[model samples]
Target: MTFAVNPNASLFLLPDPVTCFRSASYNQIQTFHLTADASAVILDWVTSGRRSLGEEWVFSRYYSVNEVFVDGKRIAKDAMLLDDSQIDAKPLPERALAERLRPYSCYATLFLVGPQVQAVIAELVRRYQAISVMKMKSPDKVIWSLSPITGNDYTSVIVRVAGEETEDVKGWLGEGLEPLRQCIGKDVYRQAFR
Candidate 1:
């Protein structure tokens, strides 16, 4: 899917999670074009198939691409490809895609750009910088990272998260993006989380 945000306009994109069924392959590409003064919030996420049926990452492959452009110049492009059939385990135990992404059943990526989201970006940066990573005996329930996109005047940020449960990630994202309620309106923001 493609989107174009006009100058001085704001856009919010929060789509449903993509679920790949057994032996299925899924591919998605999303592009966003925005003027220098435009602002946008985008969310992309995927699940480990139908967990209740024990179909965790049983799909053959999954691919996704997200690109953002500002003022006709590309600022950020993120791509991910996961294929279980491409690996060749010779003489050793075969490793599945699930093994590579073990301890996490859900993954999400969010993009915040333009002047409207500067406050949210600043808050995320503050919270992310305050975190102290320490050695843990077991993996944590959820993990996330925040990075700023260069060449955007510090107005763009990308956030990636992985969680053991989908709901956990959703809750975390909802809380983290609470500041956007003022920009996108409480009703519109609530719909995204719900």
Candidate 2:
């Protein structure tokens, strides 16, 4: 059975060379599978575009989607999206596949702003060590003095802990944060432990 969505969308199939060389019929079947699998397309990212004084600037929305399928299945068993907003700062498909595989793993992202942001981050690292969570990736923090000429004061980070809830993580790190100077945006999630 053939499946199609947007009639305007074109499909290209790269078939197995060996089978294609042996018989044209086998090549046709492989081509069919490729087109069939690609019939379903999802919009993963869209950014707002506006012109200012005849100049256009494109901002990064950081929106994306990852689809996982079962063994030998084309249909996705699970789909997850990177979602963050002022009201709801959480990753999509809360019941993700990794959650099932590793029950104790947790992930949290922090967006901080302050002059003492570096000190706050240092204290946070010390506390994370106390909790014994592995630092999966190098953090991306910006210091005022080291930052570019543009006066943008904000630091964003992603960290993984050993629990599903990041309440403790936020509470401890939130201590040194200054109300007027610091602003924290966080998103908590569960994933397979590495």
Candidate 3:
């Protein structure tokens, strides 16, 4: 839940709210539904928070950008992570996610929540066929329900973190995520989607 989607990785700009909210259209943010291939995460923008803007993967490993003048240096890679403080900063929406070198495509998942997650998921699978299937199940002990964001296209479901839980699994595999796994494992998420 606590993933550094933010370039700066700070709560100041992208605050980690305790609850997930949504827009009337059921899309509040652009989520990347990524599937982990052995050592890397391959993804296409799931739902562009800005529905009208469209999605484009900033593929650097797959493309070259020598034109974005970088003081005359050939831009091998272009990320706004110029400083550690900016780790969670949101790259201006103009800059889509850039591809990097990775030996394997790691596993991942994605989905939306708040009030519209369910409606969005249903529509994606039913109408677009983008999501073949999905089911809601309880994942947490105290939480009311865990409506996992499932789809054939996703390897990792990016759930919005609620405060310290982000720190719980901030490392990508820890208590927070472990508990989530208990709620929806590979087989479970797959079966439900299938």
Candidate 1 Cα deviation (angstroms), residue 24: 1.4
104 in model 3: Cα distance from truth in Å? Answer: 41
What tens-digit string does per-residue lDDT give for candidate 1 at 110-169?
999988999899998889889999999998898999888875455698999999999888
lDDT of 2: 0.26
- How displaced is residue 172 in candidate 3, in Å? 16
* Cα error of candidate 2 at position 3, Å: 41
Worst 10 residues of 3 by lDDT: 37-46
TM-score leaderboard ranking = 1, 2, 3
Regions more than 4 Å wrong, model 2: 1-101, 104-106, 128-158, 166-194
Which 10-residue span in candidate 1 carries the lowest summed lDDT?
Answer: 85-94
Residue 3, model 3: lDDT of: 26
Best by lDDT: 1
Query: Local error of candidate 1 at 79, Å?
Result: 0.5
